[model samples]
Target chain A: MTAAALEAARVWLVVALTLLGLFFSFVSMVGVLRLPDLYSRAHTASQADTLGAGFGLAAVALTVGLAGAGFKSVLLLFFIFVTNPTAAHAIARAAFEEGIVPWTNGDERR
Target chain B: MADADPPPGDGASADGPVDSAETSGPSAEASDADATSGPTTSGPTTSGPTTSGPTATAGAIIVPVEPTSTLRSTIAHVAEAAANDGAPALHLVEIASWRDGDPESDERAAAAERVLERVAAWATADLDDSEAPAAADVEVVTAVIGADDYLFGADDYVRVLAEYAEENAADRVVLDPEYTPVGNTTLLQPLEFALSNTSLSVETAPVDRPTRRERFRTEATTGRFVALFGLSLAFYLLLGDPTYWFDAVTGVATAAVVSITLSRVSLDSTPAIPRTPMRIARGLVYVPVLLYEILKANLVVARVILDPRLPIEPTLNRMRVIVGSGLPLMTLANSITLTPGTLTVRARDSDLYVHSLVPWAREGLFDGSLERWTRFVYYGRRSARLPTPRERDDVAILQGDDATEELPIAAADGGAVGAGDESDGGDETDAAESIDDEVTDR
Candidate 1:
């Protein structure tokens, strides 16, 4: 491939990753607002948001091209992957322990 | 796949290395070879015929045998009890599960026998090790139960054990804290619960377990230290400009300090060539599969939340998984939580309490795809293709329409929280704020 074509491909990849990240983040926001109960809200908060962060960080890594900033972004992605689910677990565990009954089909939205 | 599945052997599967019997404490480690060679008990009763019948008196103490790190400690504890209470016979029982007329029945029986005999010898040794010459008088009898039966659930194992206890007139049961009759499945909770329903007085041996922090303190080898040092220096240089002399000098200093302080603490195991690299490669392969699932589930959950009716059938389900504990368990738990529509509320032993937003997600969780993937990552592909939780009848809906809800808050908490009592004023707004913080902070 030509240098210009390769550059264009890189640009396209970064853009695609960025858009996907934004889309996931938007879904997470909607789910947070629309979902019933603390437990369900936590699902979106941990899963969708973390995925969004992953894609966004990937885009940043690609833009920086495996250099100083790129490596740091990758590290940040790893930490987010580790911590996000754990934070969600902590929240869900606390709710369950506190007797916050999860919302079911018949129950009214909390 | 469920029926065609071979009967689980005696820790001979791909997960053999991680099995508590093979890898745990010094007691379990010391008996590894001796167990395979067959029973080496000096106790007269232990050497007797398998069908010698229950000669145990009412003072007989029953200790369920498993090659756990706490096995020796449990034996020592039982010996001390025997010394104090004047118990005549100490029964070492190992439950072996096999489908009636299954081809693997003999293998299962022989494995169970080996475990039982090994434990009997350990008990005898513990007694002999003690200063009391009277300790040698405690008869150790070994029995392999449930070999002829298709023992499926925790209740089945409990039934066989209770029957043995009753026949032997053994009132007291001393449990090794690490005992799990069915491999990798956490039956201690349900086993204890079911046994409690019977006349058996069950108590876990009061052996000291390594605390979470203490788990980090494995033997610090030079290979581990060097690996950690190199990793730290690379990470440091990656963040800063490696070409700069100042960064290089500071990175070296920082890496040295980190390797010195946290080298042993950070890595779960010593980094071995081929194994470590192969695991990393497999883990990398797992990332795409996980990301694909996350995306697919995210779209599905997004549609549900975006719908006008907001179609969701939230339920809490408890699934007993056989992916071995520690890092693999954490991986499965985290992977479950990171997938949309399923949130892992709590993980106790091998049982994970997951909250699913819809039936689709609940079914997926029971299907055990992620669990199989986790097993594949840690224990290889052969161990990956086990029966799903649904097939194994190891899942229970803890809440919603189909749920029995018989397990109260205390049972669910593993006795950590209040007993069957609901804490008033849960404060929903606080929880919502935490969720908000979690999202925005990320």
Candidate 2:
């Protein structure tokens, strides 16, 4: 491929990944607001948000190639992958052990 | 404030009972119950079985039922051990090991029944039937346990008996000395060799493998040292061209040595990665699936949130973990947490507790895609193969109880029928009632 075509392809990949990431990140907030319970809301904040941030970083890495910035982006993705779900699990377990009952259909409101 | 009222969706802090009072201002409770906090704390269930008083043998011991004399001997020894330990309960589990291609007919159930019958027969011959004390040994109450595997074995293939024991909340695990099956003898080792490998995510426990410290100082850490040095060198190379390659290599080598030495001396060291190209490749497949699900999930969630009337129904779901070990179990929990619609609340032993954002989201919660993928990671590619006639049949059962659904239970003798399936009895009873209704209607 020509130099211009290669650059265009890289730019497109960056744009697409970032767009997908941004969309998921914004929708994750919707999940937090719309979902009724603590556990349900956590799904959006942890899963989608982590994936959003991961995709954004991945885009940066792709754009930067093997440069220092790209490597750092990959490292950041690694950290997020490891830590995000772990934090979610910790909070969920604490809530459960604390005697929180899960909400089911027709559950009484507060 | 009334429980009967629909959820207050007008958007002035809908976070809940903790946050409802935060309208005055964001209170400590508000911060604590925020979206990041995760999982609503609402209902309180029956008190934990252990909360009342301290009892040494208050817990239970899980023993997988094998048909051989070894199982009978194991029961006798385990009963003695339990008496010694003060534990009074024994959970006899029959793992009907069936491969994926088996017909969904009652064959697996029959296998389970045969094992349970042998256990019951042995117990009758060995123990006293009276309410009074039977033998000089401590009273061991045997509870038959069941797994809804075979149908779900692809999703619940546990490699170790200890893991199965742990999943059932039975801390004291006692296995038969060896598993000498019929003609072709398969020797099953005791739990000693099996419980060696521990969780990799955290320093949960020490695996049976050699400590990295003892081995690192010699042969194994050499590779890690080299990898670290190479990474450092790569970092430098990426930064810019170096004046002297030799200088950079030597400098990175020194740093790598110090880093490895420090880790070697550190009290808590991370687990050594069981790296293989195939495993990495399998893990990589999960990433795209996750990302794609994130895309679909975001769209679905966004639609739900953006709905005019704010239609939402939150629910909790539970399922037994049929997978192996802490690593596979953790992977399943973490994956559920990372999924957009379901957040895993608790993964105690083998039971996974999750909260789903909507009722539709909870549809295949117990027996679905996530489970198949989890089994894949735990076992291998074959674990993820499409269901044969039997597995697909389970998917139908999930929808509704058909009048002529399944006759597998009829084949099992009453004594061995409910072996480990305390929960399954209710479902089967429902099927029977549905069948009765059909007969009367006809």
Candidate 3:
């Protein structure tokens, strides 16, 4: 393929990845609002955030090329992947101990 | 008044209603159902063997008690057998003749032995039918001795038993009520006290199982795998923004450096404390409320400044805070300080001194929106008992002696007020005015 075509393809890939990232991020926010219990909400938020962040970073990397910006983006993605879930897990564990009950339809325990 | 009953075996159910040995069958089922449904009731009737046969009869075969050392292993075997029969285990520690030698040495050893045996037996029994039941275990420890040797009071024995039950997660203790009246009275009272005080699932003779809720609450949550996967995904999404990620990382690194430098400069450096889950929970609740309060305060402060009449009633007031942690208290103080017309001058345990632009703010000091907001934010639910204004005595104002107070008068020379001077009251009003001015300035 020509250099122009290659550049165009990379742009398209970035666009696609960006859209995927947006989709996951929206889903994560929805999960936070929708899930009944702190534990379940935490589960949804953590998973969606990680996947969305990963895809978003990949898109940025593709758009910027394999240089300074791209490397930094990848590093951010790695940190988020490791720390976000860890923080979520800690919060969930604490909530569980504090006796936060999971939401169930028709249950008014909360 | 009745003849003392024999010690029930591990097979006996302790939770059922007390009935004559003749009516044991029906009462046993009734008691079991009762225990399964609600809190188990403990009474003298539930303390003895349910059967009136040779096993229940007084002076019936009292097995030669083994040495205290071998008691735990023996109880383990008995518990094993009892579990096989779907029964709660029984552990008997006879503290009859504990003070045989010199009052000090012999009695202490005997007391120690009694405590150890009860503890071991209780632990072994709890392990027997646990969810992941340890190897079926029973412990029957009998400390046979003359009447005078029972040196330690029953209360001490109960205390030891309770500690053991908590440590070993034992459900119940079975004591033989066949001893002398004094011994029986002392033992029963303390046993009841221990059973009530500790978190153990206790049952007296005959042995019975605990309720289903007790069992369910103790079980670990089942969906950890799904939770782990979901969390992983969220992390990946957050990392997508390279700029934000780098900024946060750099921020954290800078914070660490600052912390280290501060530590080196002074022996009592501010530590870099991670936000605890409880604090985060409180923050989630408080941030929104704080924003609303700030908005309200800003509006009030603006009205006071803009109106030529300057309907301001500046006053210093102290408020009491009920939260326990330093971080939450700091958050509360900072939040108050951040809002217009209110500045936190001092904060001590359960008390805060605030300087308000309006005197009405004092009315709300302990009874107003901020106090209510603090309580709701700190404790997810409201309690009937709210802290009183008297509690405010503890908090004091650091500033607001009229020396630090600055009015909104512009300098007579027409020069702009210094930033330091403006900050007292003029700066905050100016900031608010500028934001509003920008909307108008636009």
Superior by DockQ: candidate 1 or candidate 2: 1
Fraction of native Cα contacts reproduced by each candidate = 0.67, 0.62, 0.00
Q: What TM-score, to 2 decimals, does candidate 1 have?
A: 0.64
Model 3 CA deviation exceeding 4 Å by range: A1-110, B1-282, B382-442
Which residue ranges in model 1 land beyond 4 Å of their true spot?
B1-58, B62-85, B91-136, B141-278, B396-442
What is the C-alpha lDDT profile of model 3 across B156-210, one tens digit per residue?
Answer: 3444555444443345453332212122123455555545655543333332223
Candidate 2 similarity to native, TM-score: 0.48
Best by TM-score: 1
Candidate 3 residue-wise lDDT at B250: 56
Candidate 1 structure quality by residue, lDDT tens digits, B1-442: 0122222322223333322121233334333433433436423354222332323233678988865656766777886665345456788887765443443356657766666666666665554443332344466788876666546556667778888888887888888887766544577888888778788888998877542222212333577898899999998888788899999999999999999998756765567775677667888889989989988888888778777888777888778787645577789999999898899998765567899987778778888999999877875676688898777766767676466333345654556532212232234234324423433211
Candidate with maximal DockQ:
1
Rank order (by lDDT, best first): 1, 2, 3
lDDT for each residue of candidate 2 in B1-442, tens digit (9 for 90 to 100) = 0122233322224344532121224232332321222221111111113232324534556565555434545554554344335443445565554333333226545655555544543332222211112112222233323343332221232344445555644565554554322112233432233334332111111122232223213443455555555556666555545567776776677667655675333312123355333555677787777667655655665667767765655655545555544466667777777766677776544556666665445544534677667667545666666553123333212112332222222322323322123243335445534534543210
Give the TM-score of each candidate: 0.64, 0.48, 0.27
Stronger candidate by lDDT (1 vs 3)? 1
Task: Report the lDDT of model 2 for residue A45.
Answer: 82
